[model samples]
Target: MPKITYTQPDGVQSVVDVNEGDSVMRGAVLNGVPGIVAQCGGGASCGTCHVYVDKDNTKPLPEMHPVEDELLHCTSSPRQDNSRLSCQLPVSAELDGLVVHVPETQI
Candidate 1:
């Protein structure tokens, strides 16, 4: 399992352990973390699970797929170089301590 830190828009944070092979959005949903909506249930079709991965750690995450890239452009929050859809991030031991910042809103 890998522990991920989720920082909500209001500045509250939750550090949760995610099972390997599970999506980061799924981990947040299962743990009741107050940021990710995961409207499409881990599917890349929805942009509701948008997150801003800490810039320093972004390089370690897998590259964004074309579908995910396309969906990110639709996020309620502005997308940045560090922006990512949590649903597209799979957990792994190498990602332990990854940090993600949730936007103020997800439309």
Candidate 2:
């Protein structure tokens, strides 16, 4: 299990042991963390799972796919250099202790 943390807009943090192969969005949604609706499940069809990847230890994440990029641009949250769709992030040994910041809101 990898330890992943979700920083809320109010600065509260929810940390959980994300099972390997599980999407970050699924871990958050299943754990009842706020700010990630994951409306399209893990299909990358919706930007509701948008998050801002903290620069620290972010290099391990996969590059943004064209679809994810397009969807991020259309999200209500302001697009950021670190913007990522949580559903696009899969838990892995390389992602141990990963930290993700939940946006103010997800559309």
Question: In candidate 2, which residue ranges exceed 4 Å CA deviation?
Answer: none
lDDT of 2 by residue, 1-107 (tens): 88889999888999988889999999998899999988888899989999988877644888889999899889988999989999999999888888889998786
Every model: Cα RMSD to truth: 1.1, 1.0
Separately for all candidates shown, the number of backbone clashes (residues 3 or more apart, or on different chains) is: 0, 0
Predicted candidate 1 versus true structure: per-residue lDDT over 2-107, tens digit per residue: 9999999788899999999998899999999986889889879989999999877743788899999999899989999888999989999988999999998888
- Global lDDT of each model? 0.90, 0.89
Cα deviation of 71 in candidate 1 (Å)? 0.7
Q: Model 2 reaches what TM-score against the true structure?
A: 0.95
Following a full C-alpha superposition, what root-mean-square deviation does model 2 have from the true structure?
A: 1.0
